[model samples]
Target: MTLFKVLSYGKGFKGQAIWASVCSIVNKLFDIAPEILIGIAIDVVINQEDSFVANLGVVDPKEQLYLLGFLTFLIWAGESIFQYLYMKNWRELAQKIQHRFRVDCYGHIQQMDMRFFEDQSTGRLTSILNDDVNQLERFLNIGANDILQVVTSVVAVGAVFFLISTKLALLAFSPIPVIILGAFYFQRKAEPRYAEVREKAGQIASAINTNIAGVATIKSFTKERHEKKRISAISDEYVMANESAIKISSAFTPVIRMAILTGFLATFIVGGLDTLNGDLAVGAYGVLVFLTQRLLWPFRDLANTMDLYERGMASARRILGLLDEPIHIKDHAQAENIDLSGNIEMEDVTFKYESQTSAALKQINLTIKAGETHAFVGQTGSGKSTVIKLLMRYYHAQQGQVKMDGVLIENINIVSLRSQIGLVSQATFLFNASIFDNIQYGNEQATEAEVLKAAKLAEAHEFIVKLDQGYQTTVGESGVKLSGGQIQRIALARALLKNPPILILDEATSAVDNETEAAIQRSLKKIADGRTIILIAHRLSTVVHADQIHVLENGEFIESGSHETLLKNQGRYHQLWSIQTGGV
Candidate 1:
């Protein structure tokens, strides 16, 4: 995914890009015509009896100047027209390519496995989507056109020089190879420095985003000054990185300038002698001098143009590398979309996280029949929530099988399977939208009355109506405007609106206060009967009423029975129960 690949991806715009480049070169050709006109004006003044213009039928010198003036107007008008064209075409091309990059990159990112996100930082991804795309936009808008025109100018002018006088042309073109070599050398050195600068930019963006999202934690810990110092350190690193790139880019112009001077001096001394010795026309000699400067001067901007190119290529590689990564989870070619029963089963399932040495869930096997309320309780890291991940197929089980209604989950269409399952987790995340929008997210097709019904069933309507804007209240980022209990209930309302055949509530009420816990428990009792419920919790008190409770210890189910039956057995569940109830 180099700069060439970035361009190749825009083959959709190939015809347009080609035309825009053509316009740039054509405009420069006309722009350089005025210098040639100046040389002819000199010819008319010095060789009045038989000048080039006189040979074309305008015998009078006065009339020749007037004719040259008319041609000047036409040539300039042509230059202006193509200049406008190249500018519009190039800028629009930049916009189209940028749009393509963002849409394709983001769409691909969404389809990648959940494990991909775990290994990447939000800020770094944001940098690629926004900053990297913009970098390519800038280069496409102007840098590309400038580079093409500069090369055209060199080629066109070099041909003109050689046609007039080969010996003098050699002098004018002597330093061109050196100037080119210097440019390549600068690119080789600036490429990696600019790449480092881009990395620093992502780190800085990540630091700022993390701090803003966790402002409350910083405030509670009273670490504003410490955070500022950390942010400043990151900012300093970004500055130093840019400084390194600047050092290389800034040297390009001056170095190329020396080469330009060498070309100019050789043409000046040699061409001046040729004219004085009667071997060259004074007018032609004048043209060579002006054209030499025209050809060499623009190479100065080659520095800035290459600067943009290097930065853009670095960004393109990162963005394209992300797109190149293969997606691990995909539906089978013939996966069926069928209705699911509430029954669920896990048969000898063994799962391990990529970062862990041991299995998170070792040889776990369990089942929940239709319309059953099952609970799993265990210590943290005991794989209580790992079951939910397995059920959702967020990560594939390393061993064994998970099935829904006697059908292997891997054979079911992912979209159909997820649509039938509803989950409300410990960490509730709501969009930056109104309360109504968040709830409606579960079933976007749900009517207003259906949302209201879902809210009432979850016991959230009473408090929602008291808010200043009622259902219209916007939840700040991640619903930060609401309390823990309010957020949890809203999440519950969202899941209830989905009306899935299977529901998983993982630590759903773990963070709420005693009163809120009682309220959620009451709501749970009302809605737990019609579907299969899998409740994973760390608090033993909440699951005591489940129809069947399982005690998970070190990734294995140590005991399972009705709540009262397990308590009577005095097993692990009973010990956890006794501790919560103060050994009653």
Candidate 2:
């Protein structure tokens, strides 16, 4: 859908838009009146005794001139006032639309299934949120107002021309059809070129984002030169795409200028000849000449306008495409509420990532009673994290139901279901914010004392206290200011502060040093005392004390027993332990 049409659905802005458009059109009409006035002034100066105003009603030339001055002041004032009004309305509307669209897009992204994120890269998503949204904003800020004024200029000038001199006006307006047709042709051709430019820009954004995010990896591998060449290639493609569109757009104004000059010259030569032949008045000839420029000069701006529209339309398509993404996994209307007591069950579960893919999980069945601690140990690509993701309702198993306290998870409202579960993953992400803010992010209502308590439990408080500003210290982008162990601890503290009845720590201690891991283990033991804990870890030491351990491989649970019992079985878990710890 077009931006205006998409935005028109907002009943709240309809009246404002109408008022703004009315003011805008009226302002342009008044703006065109000055050229008409200039023609009338010439009429009065050259034919004072028999001017149109004197012949009509005001026979006194001095009174007529004063009346003209009054009208001139009114016209100028009206143009200035409405100019301000339209600008204010257009800019404010642009801001509001941008804000609303960005929020809606972000909210939709949040609701999307984890599989969507797993398959997509962070850099690409960043391009959509930042670059795509700004493109729409830039269009609305300027293009909408330009189009309105163009339409107003055409209609208002055409009406005045028809009233003043039909034949001469017709001659002057002759080139309009040709100009408009040419504009449409250029618009059609330039649109695809601009779309390519926008796509290339998105790729550029993705490449830069990926490189910055993986700077450490590039440096470690001594691949900066290779990375630079890759980035340069993408950047060059972006520049070339823009240049292709620019070449076409630059040609537009010159061609339009030549067409507009044809009409201007027609008015100048024909109208002057008519005046000399006494077929038209001098002032009338002047009006036709001056109005010709007023009518056609704005088309010069069409190059800029068309350029803006193409960029906006290209960006709009991408933004709207994101908005149009179907919510395939919808919440049930009559969904039940999940109890705080976390009695969870997965029954005969099976799931596939997409329609064409084989099941990620098959015939999975398990149960965890309230306040029990369970763990899963597995190799890479074993679908261990996938289980936690399922529990979090990121994806629904097609074949079987997942239950929380006898209420099917699909039946529970997603918000409430999530509120009761706290998850800490191996890749712990911390926002660029104060240490205190990051810790309190999960539980915004948490008191400072409560935040400190959680931080202390996760062994994050000690390092935080040692920082220059203690809890108030800023964590650089993605917690780059802190070490991996520190970021993990802070993330753990954030989850701890949430104090959910159900906690899922998916390899939460995998990145930390042994000393930090021991501290986290102590914290985990204390926290797991009264909560339902599902620990998914490749680190065997972390889950050794769990009440039960499930060894998963290729999405299936191959062994289930106490940690010691699994070790005694001499199976996959035992083999993993031996390989990892050099113990038999």
Candidate 3:
């Protein structure tokens, strides 16, 4: 059933699958011909001028032997040719399917909502994409062909046995039902075990990924040995899971072999007795003995084939299940691109995280006009960053409307809407690439001159040029090579390069020193001519010159005014400002 599901999912490759299967069956047909040829050669030697070959008009014994040798050459050559064809077709098909599945799965993951990622681990997803997808590819490349050939061998050889003698044919196939029942039993027992093995594999992958990502923390805490033991514990669990599956699968082969041995011995002893009594031809008995091994030997490989099938199907289920995860945040059906002027409004908006009991933002109403500078100053968990997330449409508000320029945010094409806003968050992420590439990532089509200009505006150019490689320098993963201040400045420059109508600095200057922060503030002033700027910061000094500041406490604005007006009111904003300025 899982095989059929996988095949249905990849129906575009049906032609290649059929071609590979045909080649496998044909090669198997040629593979069995040698035994029949050996039987014919024995007949020729035993019957001489009255041989089956002579009956075909050869008459001479030597010429009959020569004809048989020629047929042997052709059969071997045909077998080799079809073997190559099937291998090439099957392997190539495997590569194509693997490539398509990985690409499509990754693309689907990119489109998933933020909540989906909250529930899944990066390591588990990576295992599905890399290990699980490759598992299926392995089955397609080898196991599929093996299955086809085994069936072909049984059907072709069985037909020959029945044509020669019914009673012996019946006896030869008697153990077949037993083998079938054993295979079914093993498959049923192994399915869940292999599924658990795959799950354990994912868990170990997650553990390793987590440890590697947090190696710095572990080292700082002097817990290297502890982490190692933790990972070893996970690995041991994985081994145990695999051992459980292996025990079930391993028992299959011996059971099948015993059944096959019964069938082989029955044909050998009975057919030999029949030949001696003159009831069966000596040549026919020889064919039956040789063909019985050919018919039954492949069943021994059934255990290994089923092992691959169960593992592959388990991985297939995980991969397909990930692909089926719903995309909760989707653009409206009739959504169209719009040229926004950055007029944002959240009218009585309420939002709660799926895992949380309390609302993050509660019936909040706010508005920011085009080309205006506004700042949200709040304590931790006061929903400053939540506002930015809603504005970017990363998460939809559970109630009320978020609109941009009078149009509901969901009604606008998501990509077009996000493209018009440049965001530099507190936690900056940079790829492991040259500094110039990281800055240019904001707008891929940005010119080198434009990137340099944005870097200058963010006050990162002076420090960057002082470095050994300057803009060409490689920043390690997540900009680990740079200091926090430097990384934050580069993130700002990247956003500046986008030159969007709205620029959001969500605690963007939190990592910089006072001097660097002052320089960035001056740069922001110069660039604040025709763009909307939303600043979320704890540093009251940085937002002193903003056109307006809203003080939020527990997801509601308790005070809203210009810096001087809020200070004059002597409310929560005045208390925060006084504490920071040491005037409390």
Candidate 4:
């Protein structure tokens, strides 16, 4: 996105922006008059009734004094009101920008393809979305407004100074060049240092996330000391990066202070001499002295303002980089909704993992007629799971197509296409939520009755009913609270609840014992009727009754036949069956 688009986050708040800006300008205007007021008060005591305001109109000295007091009250009061208004606007603008950027970042991330996530670290994304965005918000909330207000102060004060005494104004502004040059020098040096800090921070966050996620592995290998050392290294790198920026930024205030002192002394000496020689009035001299400090002291804060600006710009670059990641895979403009009816086919297809050097499936073709049970039998890495992945459209095929209902899968809306299929994998994953929630996760709007029915069909109802809280029991992270068999059955129940037209069981019973596997097979037999079902399991006995079976070896289908035919031929399927059943 362009800078204008990003800044447009403040569009709807034009009233707030204008009111706040007006308040800030007015506050500074009043603030500059106080020195003039000091000079005026001195003039009143010296000139008596002939004071400036009195000489202009009123002859009463008392009323003139009252008028001075009223002006003082208005100046102080205007300053206070504007202070409140600007603070409110800056804070509200910060909140709106923070809310907007975070939502847009998340929305963009959601639109990215699965491959993008696979190649990026979760901790890196988390840092960008949370910490990086927060840094940008902090700068906008205070820094941007401060810069604006400071510029206004310089301009307002400069015009007044030049109007009263051009020579004194020139003297007062002598240190400006020095201050600007110092700020520029430091800004150039601080940019890379701050960028390094952000990078190191991301590294530290990534290390912490990895260690926490793999805590079990660390304990299993007795590598606690090793992990601690690794974390310490990352933390130290971040600290060093911050220290580098701090070293440079810390010198900013002192240098500007020296330059400011020079300007203040010049204004006091030259303007004071002019007044003594009667070349300038005492009131004018007083205004010059007070205004000089007012104009120059704020420059001392340039170090802080520039610090915030540099940090904000660094963070903005990182955020924009993430948002700029090119999307390779997206929904085609002409893609239509999938009219799914469970009929599936693989036509002369060749597929490969994005990270792999060779294809996993080459020119393989197959068909599953509507509402039929088909089985894929393969050794490890023999392309059984690849076939399932192609059918699910997790990775696109390099050549040919996988189709659903006679339409190319690429032409189908991903949401509609996936909605028609349900899968239960070997290592079942469950969220740390209630059992009912886990089951209902397959179809979030599923009713309690539907969930129970699905659980009963998967033979999970017996154990679920035996639990302390029944379906309400918290499953713990990844179902660590349940046994292996219980998790598999719960996963099966989840898939059953979806009631999709096509079902895939990828070693769904491989993790279970004989009794549980048999129970699952019984449920599968019942549910497999009038639906396209694909079973992938090591236990060949499960697919003995399947309508068709394909045995794979080395990414090629070696045999495909019924149980009787395969047994008669005594091919790979027969050998797998004999090995699984112990040659019974």
Measured by TM-score, the strongest candidate is 3
Candidate 2 regions with alpha-carbon error over 4 angstroms: 1-4, 7-11, 355-357
lDDT of each prediction vs. the true structure?
0.90, 0.85, 0.91, 0.84
- For candidate 4, the C-alpha RMSD (Å) to the true structure equals 2.9
Candidate 4 residue spans exceeding 4 A from truth: 1-5, 9-23, 30-33, 55-62, 426-428, 510-516, 538-545, 562-569, 573-584
How far residue 77's Cα lies from its native spot in candidate 4, in Å, is 3.2
Model 3 regions lying over 4 Å from their true place: none
lDDT of 4 by residue, 130-157 (tens): 8888888888777777777677878988
Best by lDDT: 3
For model 1, residues 388-449, the per-residue Cα lDDT tens digits are 98888788899999999988889889999999999999998999999999999999999999
Between which residue pairs do clashes occur in model 1?
A: none
lDDT of 3 by residue, 1-584 (tens): 66787777668988988898899999999999999989989999999999888989999999999999999999999999999999999999989888988998999999999889889998899999999999999998889899899999889999999999898999899988998888889989999998898898899889899888888899999999999999899899999999999999999988998999999999999999999999999788888899999999999999999999999999998989888898989986899899999899999999999898898899899989999999999999999999999999899999999999999999999999988999999888999999999999999999999999999998899999999999999999889899888898899899999899999999988877887788779878988999999999999888998898999888888889999999889899999988999996
Give residue 366's lDDT in candidate 3 (0 to 100).
91
Quote the lDDT for 421 in model 3. 93
TM-score of 3: 0.97
Q: Which ten residues in a row have the lowest lDDT in candidate 4?
A: 1-10
Ranking by TM-score: 3, 1, 2, 4
